[model samples]
Target: MIRIALKMLVGDRPKYIGMILGVMFSSFVITQQSSIFTGIMTRTFGFINDSPLPDVWVMDPKVQYIDDIKPLQDTQLLRVRGVDGVEWATPLYKGLLKARLSNGVFQNCNVIGLDDASLVGGPGNMIKGKLEDLRRADGVIVDIVGAQGRLAKILPDGSRQTLDIGDTLELNDRRAIVVGIASISRTFQSQPVIYTTYSRAMNFAPRERKLLSFVLVKAKPGVAISDLARNIQSQTGLKAVTAEEFKHMTVMYFLKYTGIPINFGIGVLLGFLVGTAIVGQIFHNFTLDNLRYFGALKAMGASNGTLLRMIIVQAIVVGLIGYGIGVGAASMFYHVSKKSELAFRMPAELLIVSATAVTVICVIAAIFSIRKVFKLEPAIVFKS
Candidate 1:
């Protein structure tokens, strides 16, 4: 009985292929679009992730996200450092400043300032020079992406010349020499990233009373991170969050305030609808075309449960094949887009989500065929 059912499913090549394509397209769109969305959301807190040395981030109470820098007074650092369970605390200055490229072109850049003594929060991947190079007079480090792309000098021939070590940039009339090239994660805004000392960044930034952007703290041995965060907040009257909490805050802010979720959601929903319409309709017709065979089995004393199992087996086979191919294609797309700045990340959980989605599409398709099979009468086997 099962062999006959399997043969019936594969006997019609056109309908079988049509059902597979429908589910394949659905899974591909859902997985691909969701991955891009997750990649972009991950970048919103990329700076926080890059500086993994910090256990908690201290900032002004009103700061909503990583990019939403609410400057803290210089005194705030001392106040946070005074909190219990703090092994060490460092000031981090992060802000956007206009950079006058060596070519005299002006571009907006994300300027990060690390502690002078510890050089904490500096980029991990130093491509050209040492991280300590920032200690040099008027020295700074440029992210490789910025050096090769945005901050690169535009030549007269319409090509870009990558900025090398010792290239000079003018920030707020302050001369900053690129002493090192570091590779860092891409920023949310896709701007050039420049790293300098706390004092130099203050100079580059527009004159303001509050220069500290955040306080990066390291908890002492055996101290509870969450407790330390609460203690810091209570003592300093500022907002303190662990790295993971801050990342969640940033992601939530974007999801609540931005259109990113809605946009990608539309693509996924469309895929679901397309899969339902095509697969459901074709599978139903295929079942109807085989009504005579089902009725013959019913007359032979085959239970309805047995016939229902046959439909389920067919759906499972098609779903697995379609889903396997769809996810494979998406993985290929991810690799191809890696070089082109197309943000794509496929974590293990994403694969599970895609599988569930494909399963739902298959179940819905099978339901239509199931209803038709269950309603058939064995008398139909003798007609025509």
Candidate 2:
């Protein structure tokens, strides 16, 4: 019975292909859009992800996210250190500073000032030069992406040159030498990242009363990280959260306050609707055309239950084929786009979601066909 049903479905080349393409289109759009959205949201907390050494991040109560600079007073650092269960606390200065390129062009840079003593919250990977090189006079480390991009020097001939060690940039008119090059995650702002010591960053920053941006803390051995974070907030009247908690907070803030989610959501919804329309209409028409055959089977003692199973089998075959092709294409697209600035991440969980969407679309398309088959009349075959 199943073999006969599949032969009936495959005998019509155009309709078979159409049904597959419908589901494929939906799977592709849903997978592609969702991956891009997830990648972008992940970048919002790129700084926290890169600074893996710090277990807790302490900031001003009003600071909503990493980019929100509600600068804390310099004394806030000492206050956080005074909390019990803290192995150590280090001050970090994060702010935008204007840089005067060697070519005389002015560009803004995301300046990260690590603790002068501990150098906590520095770049996780160094492509060239040592992390200790920041100790050199007027030294700064530039991220590799920025070095090859915005921070790169432009030639008089209209070409650009990648920044390298021993290159110099002027920040706030203070000379900053490129003593190291580090690999850092690209931030949400997409600004060139510059790493310098806390005290040096203070000089580069325009004079402000509160120079401290955050306090990076390490918990004592065997201490509970979450509990220590809570203690820090209570003792200092500041906001403190574990690293993972801070990351979740940042991603959630963007989701709630930004239009990013809505934009991608519309794309997925359109894909589902368009797929349903195409597959539902064509599959129904195909079933109507084949009604005489179903009627003949009924006349020959085939029950409605058997006819129902046959329709489901046909739907499953088309659904699986379409889904496999669509997801394969999406994965290929991601690999090609990775070489460029495109942000795309498709995890296993995302694949499962895409599969579920395809399954639902296929089920919706089959519902109409199933109804027609169940109502088929055995006498109709004799008339035709």
Candidate 3:
């Protein structure tokens, strides 16, 4: 029965090809759009991942996303340190600073200022010079990848020059030097990052100290981070979360409060439904056009179950082929976008789930076509 069904499905090349294309088109649209959406969400929290602070992050209770500026006070920092089980607490300033490149073009850089000595919130990875260079009153560190484009100087030869170690640059009109270039994975937000001392950031940056964005806390040994975070929140009236919890919070904020995930989800859902409906309709029509053959089989005492199996087999074949094309096309787009300045990445789990969803939609769609075949009267073909 299986062999006969397989032969019948494979024999009709033209009809099945239409079904395949429909399925593939739907799957491809959903996968590519979803990947782009995921990339944007990752960018929203790039700063959280870039920081070299404690396992827990303390933020203002009112802050939702990292971009929301809510700097803590000196008193708040002391309160956080007073919490039990805290090894050390430091005030890290996060703010936007505008600097004039050597080319005289103004660029806004995400200024992450670390506390002196503790250096809690600075970029941990530096390529050209030591991280401690940020301790200088007029020193700053920039990401090598980031500095290459926005901050780099174009020399008289029309060639790009790296912000060399010990090079001087302006941060808010202050005398700031590029003491080091950080070597780290490209950050989200697609903005260049520069690290400076907390004091310099407070004095030179535009935003004031009441806006200290975060207080970083390191836990002493044998103390659970969650417990310490809870104490900090209670004492300081601030929100504290583990790094993982903070990531989840960001993900949830985007998924729930923002329109990004919802918009992408709508696209994916529409694609899935439209694809399934079109494929189902086409498969059903194919079965209807070939109703006489099915009727003949039924007249010869072929069971409804056998006919149903044939329809399902045809459906699965179309679904598999369409899914492959869609996923393949999406992969190509990802590769192209990744090489550019875009943040395009597709996790393995998302791929797996998306493929499974396409397969399910195809299978469900085939059921409609199979029902029509099962209902056909075997005697009808003879009459016609």
Q: What does each candidate score in C-alpha RMSD?
A: 1.0, 1.3, 2.4
List, in order, the clash count of every candidate structure: 0, 0, 4
Model 1: clashing residue pairs? none
Model 3, runs deviating above 4 Å: 156-162, 183-188, 207-211
Specify the poorest-scoring 10-residue window by lDDT in model 3: 183-192
Cα lDDT tens digits, model 1, 1-384, are 777777888898999999888888988888999999999999898898899998989999999999998899999999999999999999999999999987788999999999999999999999999999999999999999999999998888989999889889999999999999999987688999999999999999999999899999999999999999999999999999999999999999999999999999999889878987888888888888888888999999888899999999889888999899889999999988898888888898988998999899889988888888799889988888
Q: Name the candidate, 1 or 3, with the larger lDDT value.
A: 1
Ranking by lDDT: 1, 2, 3
**TM-score against truth, every candidate:** 0.98, 0.97, 0.91
Model 1, residue 284: what's the lDDT? Answer: 86
For model 2, residues 1-384, the per-residue Cα lDDT tens digits are 999999999998899999999988889989999999888888899999999998999999988889999998999999998999999999999999999998898999999999988889999799999889999999999999889999999989989999999999999999999999999877798889999999999999999999899999999999999999989988899999999999998998999999999999999899889988988888898899889998999899999899988889989998899889989888999988987777788989999999999999889888999888887778887793
Number of the predicted model whose TM-score against the real structure is largest = 1
Pairs clashing in candidate 2?
none
lDDT (CA) per prediction? 0.92, 0.92, 0.80
